[model samples]
Target: MRAAKRRTSREVRTGNRFAVLRAMYALGTPTRQELAGATGLSFATIATMVTELLAVGVVTEASREDSGGGRPRSRLKVAAGRGLLVGVDATETYVHVDVFDLAMTRLVHHDHAVGEGTSDPDRMVGEIAEGVRSALAAAPDGDVLGVGVSLPGQVEPDSGVSLFAPGWGWKDVAAQALLEERLDLPVHVDNPLKATTVAELWFGHGRRVAHLVTVNLGTGIGAGIALDGQLVRGATNNAGEWGHTTLVMDGRPCRCGRDGCLEAYIGVPGLMAQFGERHPGHRYLEGGSQTHFLAAVREGLEADEPEAHELVELFGEQLGVGLANLINMVNPNLVVLTSWAARDLGRWLLPVAEARMRREAINGSAAVVDIVTSAVPTNPVSTGMAAFVLEGFLERVGLPSPTSAPLRRLAEA
Candidate 1:
């Protein structure tokens, strides 16, 4: 009989694999010796791990490079196309689903309009499941490694549950487990802002920064923080609750039953409320056809409507005030503005917002931090969800587990 294989400590195996994956991701394409050096692992150990990775088709070897005084060295890179991950974003008005490879390249995307005030969680999840299935069917010879769902609420990733989603009327819903049961794959769940932050950290402006804040202004305003290169999911997985932060006490009421919350002033409804108050006859739908409103604003510029300009300026100032508070608290190296508002109002409103931020932010912090718009412009939520799923796949398949200590040690080494 074959000797029973002894199992190693889960922590050790996880740590070692994570180290190797980190080195691979950082180096892009590295030789065995280079990867060993980068990961602080012995050359022999790295060689064994690389061999296993190649066997599993998670990584591939490239053409050898010849050195002046030694044998040729073989380069290794992630086999991006070997597997795919599915991501779904279920919002109040729309449901978006996308499929991406391990390399985080989008393969297919699908979107559908969801009726407003449809707070039935089961029905919404079913619709999302259908969309994800459709997206997967469109993919070419790709096997799904995992699924990630991004929503507008507090999520507990470990439990695969949405603790609360006021908009969806969901409480403690096992979103990930439900998706996994339907799709027959591992699932990861996160808030839209957190997902967007992950996407930013990997491929957007946050890539080069150690600490960053991503503020998403859309149907609602929310934030995600990456402090010292780690995504800060608080004890309850609701760390960056900037939306609920009171900007004005006893002001406008928010959906979360709070008065004068930041979301009440900067969210889509707030903008439309301001528009309606100013232009009583103008019919604009909140969170619907924002392009129409933006067009109207452009036309107003041509017609020189003072009210339109004033509303835009006011929106900028309010946004700036909230951002200034965040800047003072986090003191991030970078701050990214995401969602439809940022895309539409960024150029016109950024200067105003920046001016306010400069006025309120701590001395020199304003100058040190780079406040910019999100690079992933089209369907950021969908892209972010895809990135989140890909990261989970990476972790599941012994690529890398995202942890602060290991990453810090690797950087130092």
Candidate 2:
């Protein structure tokens, strides 16, 4: 049997530092004592971590907290201007990049379009690199810590390889290495489900729930699951491919060459197919832009068009059925619909989906789960990728000293 790897002192220290930093980031400015309470670390350890953060200019001292007794504790916050982090969201239609500061404030957003079948590994890598460059160009003065990218389909977490991206026709692609080489920066890659889920966990409805599932609804469909406040990555890091599950026998053809898959009925393409069937000669259909088609559908719905209402009602019921299965399997307290498709159609879809979900779900599970639309104001996948880059930055901020050389150089600059 393979031996397990033990945690080194540096790793332990890094984890401790991240814990402290994450607590402060989430709780706003907090005293060392409060950080200790939140992270369950000793007060001395929190103090040491805070000192290291301060030395690196990654954190700054804020107003003192009233202790309600002696010795007012000084609050510390993550410094918003220390450095920048880049997040790349590579979807089927576009490669979107956003630059953010240490405090998670978005500084710039850049998007590059990808033509149909622009799935060559080299081309995708180049497009993503260009998008990141465009975003970084907007903030030339800040120190960019690292880049986190969200690629569609299955990704090998440890090696950062695109194991199998069906839409891109990529298998065993060295995505991380290629991106790092192209951009000359550290790159971390994962799928959209994981990225969007992390964003929801940090900034959306999942923040208040221990058991949460974030459903990614876009050109593709999947789920990102969290149980007991921990992200669930199954064996081989492919836990959330819920889109390929069989929803009906001999129903619709799926991209995975499967019949009756959930995605075939509810994904963006599936919805477009339904709309095309309803209105065989719509102008938006001729343009072949899913975005334009969805917009037109929304317009039609607002105008009380019978076809649009019928399509949405059917779509909602199908979506609810899918959610019911997911809820039954995960038994999560909350399921948040996220990504572009949900953001665009949520207001019209949520009520019908929820009602159908309750009817289809097991009564006990349905009673506890609350299905809601995403609350994140930004692109969730990109925002989550930024959070990932931030975590990586914090983990290695001061590797060998009170202030790492990199941080010192950035601060001096």
For every candidate in turn, the CA RMSD to the true structure comes to: 5.7, 5.9
Residue range 271-388, candidate 1, lDDT tens digits: 7776777777674443455456665665665577786678778888999899999998899888899876787767777888889999989887888887889986446677767666
Best by TM-score: 2
Q: Where does model 1 exceed 4 Å of error?
A: 1-27, 32-55, 285-305, 394-400, 403-413
lDDT of 2 at 283: 65
Query: Whole-model lDDT, candidate 2?
Result: 0.81
Off by over 4 Å in 2: 1-17, 37-45, 48-52, 65-69, 397-413
What is the Å distance of residue 178 in model 1 from its true position? 2.7
Residues 184-213, candidate 2, lDDT per residue (tens digit)? 998889888888877776667654667889
User: Please, what is the whole-model Cα lDDT of each candidate in the order they appear?
Assistant: 0.77, 0.81
For model 1, what is the error of residue 278's alpha carbon versus the real structure, in angstroms, after optimal superposition? 2.5
Q: In candidate 2, residue 88 scores what lDDT?
A: 88
lDDT of 2 at 61: 86
Which residue pairs in model 1 clash with each other?
Answer: none
